[model samples]
Target chain A: MGTITVEKANELFWLGRYAERVYTTLREFFIGFDRMIEAEEAYIEYCKIVDVPNVYESKREFLEKYPFDTENPDSILSNLYRAYDNALVLRDEIHTETLSYIQLSIYDMKKARVSIAPLIEMQKVIDNLLAFWGSVDDKVDEEKTRSIIKLGRRVERIDLYLRFRMSCDKLKTEKNKLEKRIVRTGLKYDESKLCELSSMIDSGEILLNQAIALIESLVEV
Target chain B: MEQLYKQSEVVNDLLARYGVKFGIYKNGNFKEQLFPFDAIPRVITKEEFNYLERGLSQRVRALNCFLKDIYAEKKIVKDGVLPEEFLYASSGYLAECESIMPPKGIYSHISGIDLVQSKDGTWYVLEDNLRVPSGASYPMIARELCRRSSPGTFMENKVCDNRNYASLLKQVMDYSNTGGINVIMTPGRYNAAYFEHSYLAEKTGSVLVCGSDLFVEGDHLYYRDYTGKKIQVGAVYRRISDEYLDPMTFKEESVIGVPNIMKVYKKGNVALINAPGNGIADDKGIYYFVPKMIQYYLGEESVLNNASTYLPFYQKDMEYVLENFDKLVIKDVAEAGGYGVVFGSSFTKEKKEDFIELLKREPRRFIAQEVIDFIDIDIMEGDQQVPRKADLRAFVLTGEDTYVWKSGLTRFSRNPDSFIVNSSQGGGFKDTWVLSQ
Candidate 1:
């Protein structure tokens, strides 16, 4: 690399974050959407949770359009496309096969409406993308580039929170010297132990049961 | 009966298998989108290819001479062929590069020369992309996959093999090396053309690096590995633009640029591909004078003819552009990638008047050219094979010798009615097949 222009650095960080966010959020949305099925005023409740306007006229509309509509321009599919585009530009920084995983995932994400099977058909894409991220982590060695990528994921996670207004549920956000920023998803944890917890969290480790217990501890507040 | 459509299915499948794509910003969000490949090969006959090779070579050499002179002696300006005001006023003109020489003293090591053929069969120069031009890998990779899809297509045709492009690029980098490893420097992943950056690096066996991987210490460029081993970079085929090449020298606040890399490049410790300050020679206004530069420098007539162009910097050309605003295309000198190109026919009468007044006020910002009704190539859309307007971007590598890649990138408009086929404009590309015969 000759020089990292400020514009490129911003793109690199976003590419990593958006790719990860798309993988994680898509997984989270599937779970969150499933839960809304039995809730009161389900569609409206979920809309408020995601913080997006309740544009859908019905539950069916939300299911079909919430994630796939290109017109929304901020849909799950759209964000994934954005992530992949950034990844495409940053291909040299990340592994080739890793990028291929993201490419296959977005390709699969676009056809979310076509499958007669279920959202389960997309599990492969999700798994492949997760593996891709892990490979990228193992392969890319430069700190400046890697830190910027991590920073990208951090920013994306923060934005995903702000966009969906998802109850500050995924990670722990704190006030930094200049602004509110993310540190991690727990209440003080070891960095070396994070890989294990992150994998668990990705596999639905921190769920409503965990949410309830954490809330039980803070009920007085 | 429908070979092009069949080719696309094959190309698309290959793209999926090997992976080739880029990013685009739509609705304020970035998206990684596959650069849809059309299977129909843009075929150029051996005679036409020879003509193009000669013209493009001449144009490149003349531009090279222009760069050498602009920085060293300003001979063309002294000869009264090119105006001094145009050089100083245009955005592509960089005075900072004056008196500074790059490795091997070749300004444009790789030139992505865009060209279009008219319905009547005349070729016109569309633009000269001398600044970190891309699309080489797009065709290079697409060809590899396309051949896998239809092996018979190659066996039956006389198409020129474009597989030597990477070797040519490698040779160019090696030829200019000051003494260390060759590195392919990409801005990072997420750049619009990041796939090409990495793919080319892999193909050429050069180490891929991001800006942060490189730093200049006391006029020596180094790529620091994660293990803290500093590898000296003798040459860098950087894919970033000149404005972002150095923060300390140009945009001090730019975080992606190295602080003192320019100092090191100037010190001659490292070779920069498509060196900075080269934009002056490729400027739209300067483009018109390339043929003249060839005649003056090499004492030979230009092998290529530029699309009939008018520089409003001259009174006569300004009058013609004003009168023919409805028939010509206006271009902003500083704008690139189809961003600044405006077609006269597409503008409303009111808009045409506004543009005329704008051109009068800032003629330096614009140049006008005759619209080349470029030829169309077939692309498969569903079951039908349709002809869409397309142009060719020929890649010429300059090292020990000037060699045009046997094949070039054939980008076509995906929009049914559009003429612009740049990746930035949502244009997908096809592979160009040049027959050896």
Candidate 2:
């Protein structure tokens, strides 16, 4: 089992990505939906943040089609589904109850209805998902695997902050977790290069080359 | 507030946390779904359970005798209680298990007897599952969760503590084991009863194994550990059917079966819990003859009652089945888990005629049962309580001794009108309480 078939390794990688995708996206969407409630033509600002078209005929359509829709692979519901599916096959590798919590949370999320109830109640779902992800970080036997998942979580956090134009303070916390996760995963990078990229993003002027350099530095390892 | 009787949201909450669940396949993807929990315990008084225990054990004891007779002496056939052709033609009859007596000479070490109580409180045995049956773990765990959710509920009532299921299971496996480790072999995480398999393994302290974890080398079955270490396996409570057991012996291409394990088994290096060829004992066709086997072999009258079964193999029984085709429940001898069962009353006239024609052509394939007016159990439908059809799967363990776990899994259909109580059919399960009194 430790031979780690390439397919299972890929599943592990995707499981990390998908779990983070659902988690970060839901948090981002909730914030935008709140802001759009008071802004002029709420869809424009929200769409700008999420990097999607505000093209729905109305705000109602956008709300209906977003968050929990499975038909949309980009939706929170679909991503969680994929995460759980991946975790299902990896039960022998991870803690059983850890996988169970992921499945339980996703199952509960799938039943969310189209009401204002989702807006207020979505936080509990987020907390459960975060708890599920946290349990994996805490309970996984291989600290390297936890580091890898945190890598995925950090990357997704970066994606959310860059895409949603969130305050840097929020991104800062995620970045710190990601940095701590990196220590355990054993990824190498030049300190000077990371400083340069952070400053560029802070100045709202992300250099694709510098970012690519940082990402490639880890991969080439 | 008092917990509502019947199926309720309250009970479902308890079931989910304890991992009371079943597996299903949708769009070719395997998923484990929580079987809905009905809050109402299918309450059986101490006296009633005693009667059931007597009958079920009697029925199983007879089945064991018949299994031995069919595999060895064929005395039942010679004695004219059973026909040779009937035993030979049976799909459950396995030539591989010929003349092989399991450890302790026990076959059907664990029996899952399905029963339905009628309005009059009389219970009728619907079928016998001598092969691996699930749901025992569901109610066992559910009871723990429920008692914690409401301590007073059990205090005010007399209910049997079914938590000893794991101990009973352990004893059965240990008694039947040749000498090594007790392993619960599961197909994988996707099999419909994976939860039960894993849960039982944890509770019984048996190692949970997949097909890949086992291999036969030099006529011995061995379990491969994570670090490439191999340990001899003394006993295996295989959850998979006998057909997929040793691919080399049965289905050669089965990726889920261990190769050459039969060689080890035949050499008596390890013991298979419930043993192979159990289909012969649990087969629906063989069910009709249990009472006869009891009388012929055990020298005792049947303690439990069947559902008035009419096997089509006999010309006289076939005629009777044809005449009552619209009133009887026809079951395919090979089907289990409520599959291949058809209620005559539910069929169209043309369908009934078609079934009759099929029965006439292959009389050995079916047995028609007179439908009893079985009582309905209540389940929660949102906030309202509704009556739904349900059945109990009671686990009786035969070790160096015979014992029954007090708790049994009670499965009920989610649909109010459906008689099917299979988890694969979207049914939910409840914890059964056999009162300690």
TM-score of each: 0.74, 0.78
> Which number leads on DockQ?
1
lDDT of 2: 0.75
Runs off by more than 4 Å, candidate 1: A1-98, A105-116, A119-221, B1-4, B16-19
Q: Give the per-residue lDDT of model 2 (tens digit) for A115-218.
A: 45676556766777777777776777676656665676676666666566566676666656666666665444456655665676556566554554553343
**What tens-digit string does per-residue lDDT give for candidate 1 at A1-221?**
42333444556666766776777677767776677667635867767765668888878778778878778865777778787777765555565666777777866776666775447756766886777768667866655665566655554554454445344345444112102112311122233333433343345444543333332232110
Task: For candidate 2, give the lDDT of residue A218.
Answer: 38
Please provide, for model 1 over B1-437, each residue's C-alpha lDDT reduced to its tens digit, 9 standing for 90 to 100: 24435667767866874577687888988877778888888888999999999988888887888888888899888889888887898777777788889988888999999998899898888889898889998888887877777787778787777888989999999999998989887777668887788888766768777777788887699876533468788999988878888987776767767778888888888889988988887788888887788899888987777899999978999999878888998898878888889898889889888888898899878889988878888888887878899999999889878888889999999987888898888888988988788
| Over 4 Å off, model 2 | A1-75, A89-97, A111-119, A133-221, B4-7, B14-21, B25-34, B178-181, B205-207, B223-227, B322-326, B343-352, B379-388, B413-418
**What is the lDDT of every predicted structure here?**
0.75, 0.75
lDDT by residue for model 2 (B73-155), tens: 88898988887777888778899989887777888888999989888977888888888877787777777767776777888
Give the TM-score, chain B only, in order for the candidates: 0.97, 0.96
